[model samples]
Target chain A: MREFALIDRLSQRLANRRADTRLGIGDDGALVAPSAGQELAITTDTLIAGRHFPVDTSAFDIGYKALAVNLSDLAAMGADPAWVTIALAAPELNAGWCDALLDGALAAIGDASVDIVGGDTTRGELSLTITAIGCLPAGAALRRSGARVGDLIAVTGTLGDAAYGLQCWPTRDNATRDQQFFIDRLARPQWRPGAALRGLVNAAIDISDGLAADLEHVLSASEVGARLDIDTLPTSESMMRSCDRETRLGLQWSGGDDYELCVTLNEAQLDRARAAIDCPLTVIGEIEAEIGLRAFDRHGVRWNSDKARGWDHFA
Target chain B: MREFALIDRLSQRLANRRADTRLGIGDDGALVAPSAGQELAITTDTLIAGRHFPVDTSAFDIGYKALAVNLSDLAAMGADPAWVTIALAAPELNAGWCDALLDGALAAIGDASVDIVGGDTTRGELSLTITAIGCLPAGAALRRSGARVGDLIAVTGTLGDAAYGLQCWPTRDNATRDQQFFIDRLARPQWRPGAALRGLVNAAIDISDGLAADLEHVLSASEVGARLDIDTLPTSESMMRSCDRETRLGLQWSGGDDYELCVTLNEAQLDRARAAIDCPLTVIGEIEAEIGLRAFDRHGVRWNSDKARGWDHFA
Candidate 1:
């Protein structure tokens, strides 16, 4: 299929939704009206080859992961996904690969209730940038600066699975069966935070960078410090079985690409939050008066180092 | 300066604009509330190095041209310029170059009363994509499908200056002082027909891929045919002096990137349109009953062609 034909076919598949989208695809740009009493939240993320993802990754995974990560941003803001515009750059027109990629992207968007409203296709080295727009009730959206001292720091789902999966990808023979599950989670992580927590979480952020680095972002934004307890960090059963305790804990603490939500709430609201979420909420820390992050091991020893850094685009 | 700092500087400079921008810069996305009874019109254009522009072109001109092309799209739809989003991909970050580029971009946006609301920056091969959003009254949007047979085919401003500029860029020795002026027009074409023709044009499109090709797009969309007079095509005085009559006319008829509005209007609206525009109006043709485009000379000699070919991405 040519670029125009491929876009037409994809547009047809997307038009069947008939949801909140005022205009579907086939135009210079798409038009959308926001739901009443809601503010639109928009974000753009670009995934580049050999930088954001490995070069050998499947086209399907690339497509799936591109939209998934942007959806994760919306989830962190406690917003309902609405529409997305993808600007794709690739070297040549590969019909089969394009179809597969679009399939993966549409499948992910379908699950999130987001429509592929508009996009641009061009020829260049492989790079995909997705701009997602979500809607949230007026004055009810979450922000990174809403956390207060003495708030309970909680994280949904598991961390480090994606990062560990990446580490094991280059040497499959060195990976155990349990590690394979970690790899899958890394490649196709789900980012649904459930609709119930819309009004509950105060400050929230998704763990695209490692837990330590992402937590630092919240700390810096909220102007509060945090002390994470190593014992309370959530690690998947597969992670625990495949790796030693220290390695698992270290990965849980510092590995990145985990699209899990790390949210902060007042101690008074913890009971309500605990009852709201279906996923495990690990209370690994507490916000402090000081403005930095620290980690305490099970032995009560603080792990003070400059080594537990996450992914840096410039670096 | 770093990317964030550069953005901060640029945002500060744009803070003085009085455009209908609800939110300006330094946010996840800029917010603009369309006026009551108005619909948002949008279009995106991507320019890649060695593809859309010469490699050694000045950064400032590149920036001016990038935003100008998108503004031309808004002009074609008979919309008032409102907001623009720029996505820039480059191999390296140079602060001086970035400042110069932003200067040129802001100059154009400022001129059109469009706000530089939000944008994305990434490191890659040099390419710039701009998504411009405008506003037209609920039922007054001029679309390509609204043209009717017997309507007069008109063009705003002259054509072929930009294409002529490209040819002269490689051979400075062949370019006269007057030719350089035409070259600059090609390098940084202005978008006309701002708020003046919001309700006058029956159907319109910007002449990016030359008049023959872009008019065909309008024809194909409206399912109509046109008979263009080759003798009536508009050209700059410099263009006429520098090139032969055939080449100058051919460039006016078929050259791309003029960024001028090509519109169809009834003969009844002709006098009002001529009075409304700041630039002169040239009637080049009339819509035909058949379903294809043809060109005729002043002597009524028909040029044989099955299709009006423009710039094709894949071709």
Candidate 2:
């Protein structure tokens, strides 16, 4: 009964009235009507205490990041976010804690028009599994397999701020403004909309496991390769001020938790895509006929891709 | 790298080459094409170790029940199973254990025509969260708000056997065939198809948190009451032989996890509904003008609902 009472209270805090959601919450399942000519894009992600984030991380940030990460996946597919189901498990039902967590989630979903449709609340070790549903025009899905040889590879926003933020977190109170920027980036990753880039990008993926590893997924799927210009990789002003060139370069390439979009497009579409997107877009690589990734510095010196590795949870 | 490798292996084991699933497994989000004139039904559930099931429960049964329970939700909504996204978290990635778990999930999904779409794998305390998507003809969903006065309330299959199974699980090897029957019900709750009952039933819900509790949800939603005939609830012969009368009645009313459909319909549709459904259907109650549930024996003696309380994760 306490679980039911808690869910009822939390459901009210998250509820939104939307035309597409015929039924929401308080049901066995939610009924959703998709647009006439759109296909549904579905994704699920899980965040666990002490694994995905610091053990002592605030519930507010955890809730915010959970939704942000799933929305990032939808953005990668060039789909418009519509609905989400949250399955939350916690050791106890603390009203104040749950309220703050949900408040942060609502903040992350601000004006995106996504509805919290259905969910299950259970008692267990702290974790959240969120399944986000979105819609895309029937043939407009930006699949990972569509990257072709000669396509220009681009990324939105700067990378490695989140990783740097993790390192400076313990002593965050004494940090400079530059360091605080990194910490904020770690806590609340902005959900960059990619739905407008459908016709401008050949393939797209979100940088959850770092650019080096995530780009490898697109390369493997498309059976192509890429050569990145190390000097062209984007870095934040804060990163430039706080770290040396080597550290910044490694973080830019291999540091994870940057929820930015990495896309491949033709040269002709570059200008139009930049104007269409909401964030800073930078080209750092081009697709190749060869089947693996390689990198080069400004002086044309080759850097082994193996030297900058991405995250592997089990590793 | 090992997490991705394990996911790749398990993905192959659970993959289905489906036409509706335009994109699956290896993407940020999956693209699914729902049939024209159908609304999507979405539901999510989480199963955690030591909380949802015994710590030593087989990975196979854990996988099977996780999917089964979600399917039960879809069934309650009168929807056809379509796709599922499984977010799995575990302490370690054991090859044999994962293979067996996937195999069990496959068995539960046997010939249902549902596809495994997209998911995330994380390291944490063992748990599985499954989000199930189903389809129903537009406006055909059997919601919980349509029951009315004089409507017949019916239940499918048997109840209470699962709760009995839980009690006998620790010494399952020494149990009789009848006791094993109850144990099997707990381990594997069959997925009953309810999509065919859309027009036949006015309202429906799955009996997960015991009929006594779940029925109250329907009464509360529809703004009506019910009079249940305790003598009429369907019970398995195994349940009858293993327990005394009062114990049998308690299990039937309050023991949870039966995964059976509880529905209401006009008396005129009873004969046709019984003929159409695949399983046994028995009328155990009728809607009343009052606003709460009451019970009666074969002799018409009244019984208070509070005596047979339903399971509450946090009471």
Q: Which candidate comes out best when scored by DockQ?
A: 2
Note the chain A TM-score of all models in turn: 0.94, 0.96
lDDT of 1 by residue, A1-315 (tens): 356666777777676353545555654455555545565555667788776778887788888888888888777777777778777888876778887788878766755567777777777778887777676766666777778888889998887788789877876556668777876777677776634576777788888878887787788768889988978888888887777887887788888888888989987787788788778877889999887788898898786546457665534
Can you give the DockQ of every candidate in the order shown?
Answer: 0.34, 0.77
Least lDDT summed over 10 consecutive residues: which range in candidate 2 chain B? B303-312
lDDT of 1 by residue, B182-251 (tens): 7688778888864577677788888888788788778987999998888888878887778897778767
lDDT of 2 by residue, A1-315 (tens): 388898789778766657888888898999999878789899999988887777777889988998999999999999999999999988887888888788878888888989989888888888989999999999899989989999999999998899898987886779789888888788888888989899999999999888888999999999999999988989999998899988888887888898999999999999999999988999999999999988888888776768656777787
Candidate 2 wrong stretches, greater than 4 Å: A299-301, B298-302
User: For candidate 2, lDDT tens digit of each residue in B191-232?
Assistant: 788887989999999998899899999999999999999989
Candidate 1, residue B282: lDDT: 91
- Highest lDDT: which candidate? 2
Q: Quantify how close model 1 is to the true structure by its C-alpha RMSD in Å.
A: 3.2
| Top of the candidates by TM-score | 2
